[model samples]
Target: EKTVVLITGCSSGIGLSLAVRLASDPAKTYKVYATMRNLAKKERLLDCVKGLHKDTLDILQMDVTDQRSVLDARQRVGEKRVDILVCNAGVGLMGPLEAQSLDTMRQILEVNLLGTISTIQAFLPGMKTQGHGRILVTGSLGGLQGLPFNEVYCASKFAVEGVCESLAILLQHFNIHVSLIECGPVNTNFLDNLQAAEPGSSGEQVDARTQSLYEMYLQHCGTVFQNAAQDTDDIVKIYLEAIQSASPAFRYYTNSALLPITSPKTAASDGLQYIKTMSKIIFSTNNKVEQK
Candidate 1:
């Protein structure tokens, strides 16, 4: 009996690679369903699989935010209780937080957070009835640290991290497992998908108020963005391990640079704290000079 695995956001990037890699393993006994928003946009994914020369890959349609879509996906998968679910569907919207529309922020949370919840919920009953399953949620390094200019994105991932940790405890009794992949920047189309809610509008944009708080945050950072990226395959490998391992880890960090450093003498050396302390001294000295 082949293990049925479902993955979302398979049009490109990590999701695509994960689906292809899992499906290609002939001895692994996996029936893979690779889902995307527009099944039409999966040409590259299709091409990648074709190059690998395997036919077990099934392309499906799923939009995680919609309960109906999730139900429909369940029906399509049919009879096969999903053995593993990779909640990989997510979007990125970048700009000054003040400029980000309310709808945009909601969209991010909806697709990244609620979407994962819905996907898990949709498949949970089946997995529980079967007495086992693996749930993998794609978290981010941004969730671990407060990165600059990406307030909303970071918030959503942070929420995911929190939720998944709690979920792991909850699912323990059912023999089901939940894992989170706290990844760093992987080379993906996430950077290209960013958009401003309104190019030019006098009226209210959806996320205006949240965007306002975000703008204030950027003013302190002095830089718009940072490039801490690795190849997408590196993260996909972690996802695969979480699925295939007999005893999978609860959390896996893809990029080593982003991992927390703790020495026996002093684990309190947070670089961010040191920078903040210096910033306070510099500002305080400037204030005294102005008074003189």
Candidate 2:
């Protein structure tokens, strides 16, 4: 019997790539339910899979923020059970905290935090009943460590970490595993998709100092992505490792090089070290660039 896998955010990025890879497995080992918020954007997923995945792949409309949509998608699963559930639907928001509107922050929390919770909630009972299942979440570096212009985004991701960790303990008793694939920057459209408040546009809402810092942060972001971003294929390999492991770890770091950056957070219990270190890494480097 093939593993019945369902992944959210299938319109593009890691979700789309993972779905395509699994569905096209040479042994036909997986039946993938690739879901997205809008069915209209599915052509990209279809275009990548071609017409050959008739038996191996199914596309469903699932808006993770909507509980009803999540339940409906679960109902559409042909196998009646999801052996592997990948909650990959999430968005990013970047800007000074003062410039970010309440609605925007809520949207980020809804999708990144609550959306994940709802998706898992919908399938948790089934997994518990089956007595065996894998839950993999697409996590971000921002989730582990705060970023300069991503306050709301980091908060949402941090909440997800709490949710996954909390659930992992209980789910283990049911023979179910929960794993988070913590990623660094990736070669995807996530940067494009994220809602960013341009410093110029924010005008008086953001003070000049903050505006300058935000621009520096953007530059630092660009340099990091250019130098260190991993491809989606690399991330998929980590996902496969967790899926294939008999005892999967609760967290898998996609970029080991980036792991050290998070160590200060743990090494210094007060959390001041991480903040200082991150600021120096981002702002100090940009300051040097400016001096040159």
Candidate 3:
């Protein structure tokens, strides 16, 4: 029996890549339910699969933010059970906190935090009944450590960490595993897709200092992505590790080089070290550029 894998956010990025890889497995080991918020965006996924996945792949419309849509997608699953549930649906928000509107923050939280919980909730009972399952979440570095200009995004991801950690303890008894694939920057359209606050675009006026810092942050982001961003294929290899392992860990880091940046958070119990280190890592270069 092929593993029934259902992944969200299949329109593009990690979700789309994973779906394509698993569906095209040489042994035909997986039946992939690749879902996205809009069916209109599915052509990209289809084009990548090359129309040969008739039996191995199926596309469904699922907006993780909408509970009804999640439930409806579950109903459409042909296998009637999801052996591996990949909650890869999420969005990013970036800007100074003062510049971000309340509605925008809520939207990020709804999709990144609540959307994940809702999707898992829809399938939790079925997994428990089956007595075996794997829950995989696409996590972010921002989720593990704070980042400038991403307050709301970090909050939502931090909440997901709590949710998964708490659930892992209980799910273990049911022969169900929950794992988070914590990623650094990846080569994807995520930067373009995220909602970022433009200086002076919002009603509130952000202070000049914050604006300068935001610009520095954006440049820092660009440098980091260009220098260190992993491709989606690299991320997929890590996901496969977790999936194929007999005992998957609760958290898997995709970019180990980036892991040290998070260590200060744990290395110093006071937690101020991470903040200072991250600030220096990101802003120090810009600080020098400005002086020159």
Best by lDDT: 3
lDDT of 1 by residue, 1-292 (tens): 7888999989888898888888887585788889988888888887877755354678889989989988888889854689999998888656555556677889899998899889988999999999999998888766765554577887888888888888899899888889988876677777677444454332445467556545554443322225456777888788877777998889888877656322321425555563453334323435456545
Clashes of each: 7, 0, 0
**Cα TM-score per model:** 0.80, 0.95, 0.96
User: For candidate 2, lDDT tens digit of each residue in 112-219?
Assistant: 999999999999999999899999999988888889889999999989999999999999899999999999999999999998865444333788898899889999
**Candidate 3 runs further than 4 Å off:** 200-202, 286-292
Clashing residue pairs found in predicted model 2: none
Q: How many times do residue backbones clash in model 3?
A: 0
lDDT of 2 at 111: 95
Clashing pairs in 1: 97-211, 98-211, 98-212, 101-206, 101-207, 102-206, 102-207
The regions of model 1 sitting more than 4 angstroms off are 51-55, 196-228, 260-292
Query: Which run of 10 residues does model 3 get worst, by summed lDDT?
Result: 283-292
**Lowest summed-lDDT stretch of 10 residues in model 2?**
196-205
Please, what are the lDDT tens digits per residue for candidate 3 over residues 181-272?
99999999899999987655557899889889888999999988988999999999999999999999999999987773767878878989
Top candidate by TM-score: 3
